[model samples]
Target chain A: MTPGPTPGPLPGPTPGLRIRGLVKSFGGRRVLDEVDLVVERGEVVSLLGPNGAGKTTLVSVVAGLLRPDAGSVSVLGTDVVRAPRAARGRIGLAAQDVAVYPTHTVEENLRFFGALAGLRRGELRTSVDTLLETLDLTPLRRRRARELSGGQQRRLHVGCALVHRPRLILLDEPTAGADPQTRRGLLRQVRALADDGGTVLYTTHYLQEVEELDARVVVLGDGRVREDAGVDQLIARYTRSELVLRFSGEAPELPWPGARVAGDTVFLPTDRPGVDLVKAVELTGQDRERLRAVELSRAGLEAAYLELLGAGRDE
Target chain B: MNRALTVARHDLVWLRRDPAPVITMLLTPALLMFFIKPLYVGALDRLGYRGVNGAELAVPGMTVMFSFFMAGLVTESVFREHGLNTWARLRVSPLRDTELMTGKVAPCLVLVMAQSCVLFLLGRVVMDLRVRGSLLALLAVMAALSACVVAFSFLLCAVARTRRQAFAYERVTTLVWVILGGTLVPTELMADWVGSLAGFTPVYWASHGYREVILDGEGVAGVLPHVGVLCGFTVLFVALAVWRFNGGADKQHWD
Candidate 1:
């Protein structure tokens, strides 16, 4: 099946999106505060934030849905505010909410949206056929959108956005209701898009998806971008592995920088787990025998996200 | 124009898939024609409407009245997109504001015409209601009536933020049109002040033209003035809706 536009080498060296000092307010409260972001082509950036963290506000500005009070937004080098139709034509947005037509059949919903996105009739049919198979919605193509279960509807929602094969996709919590299989398939398609030199800005609460896609993580909180780095870099910077020693008796006082005693056990957070463990054991002296068991907990992206937004925010 | 028609077809496709509009259009008119026709026939005789069968007056009048109820379907066509989470998707399409407005109003226009046909035909075949006026003049008036109501419905859809709000507005409009505009009872029978006020409602002009066609056998000469009034209301409502939508584009998005 023929794919949608390849977005290969767009005019004037257009990156995916370049946002500068964007700000938006609602009822005297700034929902997006001087936000700045840049996602180049062939990059998959996962935006992570708790509810009401302004992740929605940031992308909505880029998608040309809401105008920012200040700063500039450019999609593929075209000003989104000045050239809205041109910028929006290159962008596909799958919202946190399922936006497919409920009463229209699955096939109808996809083709209708694809046509609006300016897909030719023949190409639209082929692309839809491929999406139905790729998303595993082929069997339900004839069924009305409302007849699908939660998981099926989620896939259809994402499929509508992809049918146009947009160069830059801004997907917000696209995997919210998908089953495990569907989620995996959807991620595979996202991976394929990046591999095809397309750019993606994905927002999700699931850190596992970030890890699987190996996406660069950008965190939003308090109406601003809190952090932007590769997933591995974020995990390494924010969270360190921990070594816990369960003692049969009261553990001896350890001089390690991050060592604390709780009942008969000691919890130590260290950058070098092996070296710190040796130091702690040597310091235990005669109490070393009291160390009945040792356990190591590796740090993950979830830890980094918590460390970043885990401050005194209402989420 | 292409985008607008495509959007309109998309909406119509969904509306067809849902049985609610179809059942309401078919059943509601049939029920009103059969049950209300007899009551009006007796009631009109008591009220001194002796020259014409009450079914002819009641059917066209009630048809015009219930056509206002078509506002419900029109509003639903729009508000339901937001409910189903698709409004933002539609907005981002490469459509001009005029195209979007056309797309929105097109299906409502088609539906109102269909509804008029159903109610008028049910009166003719089922109740033996005869056309005393020029059929062409009556057809032109009905066509204008449909367009006027459709425009009113489109304005209501554009102004309403939610389904509940649209329903409330439609309810109030229905009451005003039925009581004040002579859709429920003859305007001549109402008090002098009420009759004077009825002249202001577009529905009064629409059904009043229907009365000329059904009772007085008037041709285009008689129906032209009423049709002109209906056209005026259509233009007024549509122009206001377009102004609201185009001027408030950012507000609609941020909302």
Candidate 2:
């Protein structure tokens, strides 16, 4: 196989991926509606959405696996639907489900995909060997794909996608069902790939993963993008307040503003917890010695996601 | 072409690892030729057919029988990859559909040719069957038969939605071809109408053409009709297969 011309630094103003008014429907239900997003080179964009929000559909369309009913998708400034082969050559997708052949060994799967990516025989062999080692699959290189554990298989699937060193990698729930160690390891690789100037588009239900990567999060609801911002910006925009307070003798009843109590605990969604605490002590006539532990907390992306979904339901 | 050949090489490696199909491809023709010749001889003697012996008829029939087995094996193997979404992935690559289709057909043709050669050699060495016609005519017949099988196998792959369905369809088709095309018994023993009906089938035409070349001392022109029919079947089946192949690259169901 001959290597393609060294993709000369993705010319022009196009980011790694650019989508405009992308729409798709299944049966009568609209899965993606006017979805627009972009991921610049070396940036990690996390697509966050609840179930049935069309994350997978969007990814599949961009990967050239499915055709969208409306809108246009461009990867590296090339129209994907119009010229699938040229568009797909620069993009790699690691599907949520394991896609490797069960009877083929890990090395075989990597080499096969590497060749598909237009790697020469020498380059393919070297790349496959390097990936096997990097992904910690060297020990199981000879084992058939089906024999590996789920996490191992997941790692191998990602390795296959990376063998070609594509410019943009799309991962649809790549780390789902993986243990903490495996998940972290995969994340590290993903982050490193981004750091190496490769764009990444990932989707997952794991809120913490979005937080950990600090990626630009696009919250999807009802087939539309509800929010797109940095993780901290999203949290700051949606989270209103923080509160920290303590009570004595099985948690004293404090008439705190904007507070709700259950059993001995009082929950307050407020911005000025220190003011609320002083007021609560005066209102409840509780001495300072009776106070227990008090802590302040701010809302996270999880809270924003729930709020977004709740708002979508009401609309 | 390189990408297409790469896919073929990958499949060949897997086939090599699992030797059962290779063994079946080689052994089935030999075993059928060994047992059917004596039975055919007894029946032909009873019918007062004095000019030709059983081994002569059995040799050509075995060649036709091998085509059926090769077709079924190729269908099952290729459809297994299709069911697994491997073909869909390859389709999205730079590899053209024609390349992928050619890669699949090439392997089946090679396997069928090898089987035909083994059957011919066994017939010559063990049964003293004479090759009276030009070797080119014999090769042309074998090539036509293999092409017919490959076309049908690809058609089967197109219609088969799952590996299990492909396997079942292949088995049924192979058995039907073997039985109806007179692989086990001489077509002469059947009713005249039955023999005429068998003429319409590719396997029968292939077997009859081979018999004409190897047994009847006829030139290629004498078996032109048989060759023509087999070629027609090949074209018709390949066209249908290509039609079914269009728009099949969808999101594969991951299991």
Candidate 3:
């Protein structure tokens, strides 16, 4: 295998995964069109998209299961297509669906998958033990995988992928069927993994999963990467903070600079809702006194993502 | 090699945990052999075949036939991963197609051999199956037969997309194999073309090997040719499986 460039003193880590001009088609229909994405070391890039947005397809290509019509996927500086075998050890993928042996115990499933990653005997045992505890599967380790609850199975599925501890991990909506608590557990672990220098490419429906992880957002729509930016940048460019001011009787729209009245409330779009709350009082003279209650709504990833997907559908 | 073994161990661990399929594959054939052994010996006696023992003549044939039919367990082992959704887990891993199939193949191979030996042992203790021939020769033939059946199982799995499809193919082919191989009737009674076609299948070699050792007392030297033929069929079947698997014709559970 060709060695990557020698590292110099650097502030940010190099790109662990880089895909360029990725195009894939099935039955004459293009599923991924010139998709480009980069996730640096210690970076968690959420591959956010709705159903049929080609999230799984892109993941399949990167994981070396699906060959792309045109493009290259380099994982940990090794091209997955050209050197899939070399790239395999450096990459771990937790696909959207749960894929564990139902007949085996949770620990056995963990051990089997971990061993496949080429871990040694002692290393394999240690990895499985830590993963079982981390994934909250320690108590249920001896239970048959099929006997676990839905949430528990989902967690076990994630554990199977992470048991190998690959440097570059692709989580294709791992939390899809997980309950809220299970989802939080998975997100927290993913975040901790990233903090420990693992690059994560997580795709999800729940925007909060990405939000809580504080991951960079790579919004996909129409088989293309529509937006790639940090959480703050994505929210700034695609969402607006809405400040709702309910009136005692009638909403007066003559005070706040950006306040728009709808029925009995005035809405203001601002970056800071807390500071803008005082602005509403100072800017509106009699309307502020007439204000019954104030509600500040922050611009969030959920709104930005929906708007992006909605616009893609419109186009 | 270790990777393939790990995948095999994964299957083995699960199989041992449940064990119902393996147990059924073993017992079903043993029971069938006992019922059919008497009828075979009675018919052969009435036909004036002097030295032929009914249990020896009919028991091994029934044993191999049931072994081939129960080879559908191979389909169950491979495709059940699809049903349970664990196949995709292996697919996306570093495990190669050959390695995955090799791992899946070993457990079935071991099970099929054990099933065959158990039936032969039970036949010997109860039904007057003599040691007129070399015991090692009989075991060698059984091992070869097991390989052929196991190889066929893997190939059928590679060709078919679903568990139903694999079993359907297994049913169709096993009937043809049983007929051509002379499991139900003697190949000596078969027409020229039917016997010729049977010669092309692994079943014919297994039955031919058993008769040479058990009835003819041919020993190692006598059954060598049959073992060679069965081994050839084993290679052919396994190669066919590898070809389809490598060609990417088999539908993956991940897709």
Candidate 4:
């Protein structure tokens, strides 16, 4: 085979991934439109979106599996559109679907993908072995993928992408349908990949995963990047904790401002649950006997994401 | 090239893990040749070949007919990638579309060739079937026929929306070619119109090439015309396959 173009030294430390005015359409429906994002090296960015929000389409375009209708995506220093082969060489993508060959053993799947990634014999062997251990698939290495449980297969699917130790890893909902053990292992591996200077772009609807990774979150809604910031920042900006007082019977109204009652409960949105809880108990007065329980619902990434998407939809 | 080889090797491993379909293809043809030899012997006698055993006819006929069935291996392999959702992963790899197609089809070609040659070898050893002509000529015909079958399989894959559609086309086409091309009954025994139409099929060219080498004692130079015709069919099939195939198109693995 003839050698391909050799990459020269970069002018500076290039962003792990850079996208500008990216657009994609399917059957006249715009799936992605003017989406812009940048992720630096050693960073883990969680791509959160609802169904049909074009998260998968964006990932496909970045992985070079789908041609963009317009705009540009560059991995490290290679343009994904013009030099797809060179760009693909630097990216490892594990799509949302489990793509492992069922008839092949766990080890064989890893070896085959690692070989295709241009790893030499020794390096390939080492990488496969390390992945088998990291994904906790060592014990099941010789088992055919068809015989393994769904979680085991899911782990193997992610392992195939990491077997080559790529500089940029694109994992789309890697933990979807995974068991708790499998999810924990994958989250640890993903975090470790980023901590070791690998850039990771993860997509999932599970906001807790984003919080667990402590990743910078990018919320995609209606074919655009609606929110891009740290998880804490998003929660502070878009979410608010709620204080609730449940009643066993017809309850007295709370004096708390902006409190709303529904069914047998009163919900008071709060930034300070401690002071609000005290105010709620005092306001109940003679009807405090009807108060069955007082509960504080802490604000989290899930709430923030829901609020952000809801507001975007409202717009 | 290395990437294509990697894909080819992986395919070979899949075959190794599940050998039932291949074993059936090989054994069924060999068994049928034995049972059908006496019928061919009588036909050969009536044609004025006084002492010719039926192996001369039964061997090549069975070989040509079953090689068409071997096209299933190609369709099955390609469609299985879709079923497993691995097609997207493969496309995302560094391998180009040309290399991926080459890697996927190369093994099917080798398997078809091996299946045809093995059936002929069984005839020579067990039935005293002699190749009176150049062995090189026999091999050339087998190579050409195998290439034609593999190319035809790719065309089926490109045109069929589902695996069931591809298999249905394969079975129907193989049966039509085998009957018209004189695999079961000699073309001369059929109606005059059937004999004329037989020449239109690739199977007819393959059967003619094998007969010239094994029965007519033809050398490589004597069989070049038949080989050239089979190669022509191969080129036509490849051209159609290339035109219709869309690597990015969504194809169903099963109905």
Give me the candidate number with maximum TM-score. 3
* Residue runs of model 3 more than 4 Å from their true location after superposition: A1-14, A253-259, A271-289, A313-315, B46-48, B191-193, B246-255
Q: What TM-score against the true fold does each predicted structure earn?
A: 0.89, 0.89, 0.92, 0.92
Model with the higher TM-score, candidate 3 or 4: 3
Candidate 3 local lDDT, B39-123, one digit each (tens) = 7776566545666568776677877787787667767878777766666667767888778887878877787788877887888
DockQ list for all candidates: 0.60, 0.47, 0.63, 0.70
lDDT score at residue B127, model 4, on the 0-100 scale: 84
Which whole-number lDDT from 0 to 100 does residue B132 have in model 1?
A: 85
Model 4 chain A: lowest-lDDT 10 consecutive positions: A1-10
Local distance difference test, each candidate = 0.81, 0.78, 0.80, 0.88
Q: Kindly list the per-residue Cα lDDT of model 4 for residues B154-222, writing each as its tens digit.
A: 889888888999999999999999999887888888899999999999999999899889888999998
Q: For model 1, how does the per-residue alpha-carbon lDDT over B1-255 read when each residue is reduced to its tens digit? A: 778888888877767667687677667767876777766776677666675566876788777877788878767777776667677777666666677767877887777788788778878887888888898998898889889888888788777766777788988987897789887778877788989899789889988899888877899899999999999999999888766653223222223
Q: How close to the true structure is residue B103 of candidate 2, measured as C-alpha lDDT?
A: 75
Chain A structural similarity (TM-score) per candidate?
A: 0.90, 0.88, 0.91, 0.91
> On residues A1-315, what C-alpha lDDT tens digit does candidate 3 reach at each position?
111222211124458888999999989988899999878887788887768889999988888878899989998788988988788777788887788888888998888888888888899998998888888888998999889999999999888888888888889889887888998888878877777778888988888777777788888877999898888888888788987878888787655566688888888888777887787767768566777887878888888888777777788
User: In angstroms, how far off is A99's CA in candidate 1?
Assistant: 2.4
> What C-alpha lDDT, on a 0 to 100 scale, does residue B113 get in candidate 4?
89
| Model 4: DockQ score | 0.70
Off by over 4 Å in 4: A1-13, A245-255, A262-266, A273-295
Which has the greatest lDDT? Answer: 4
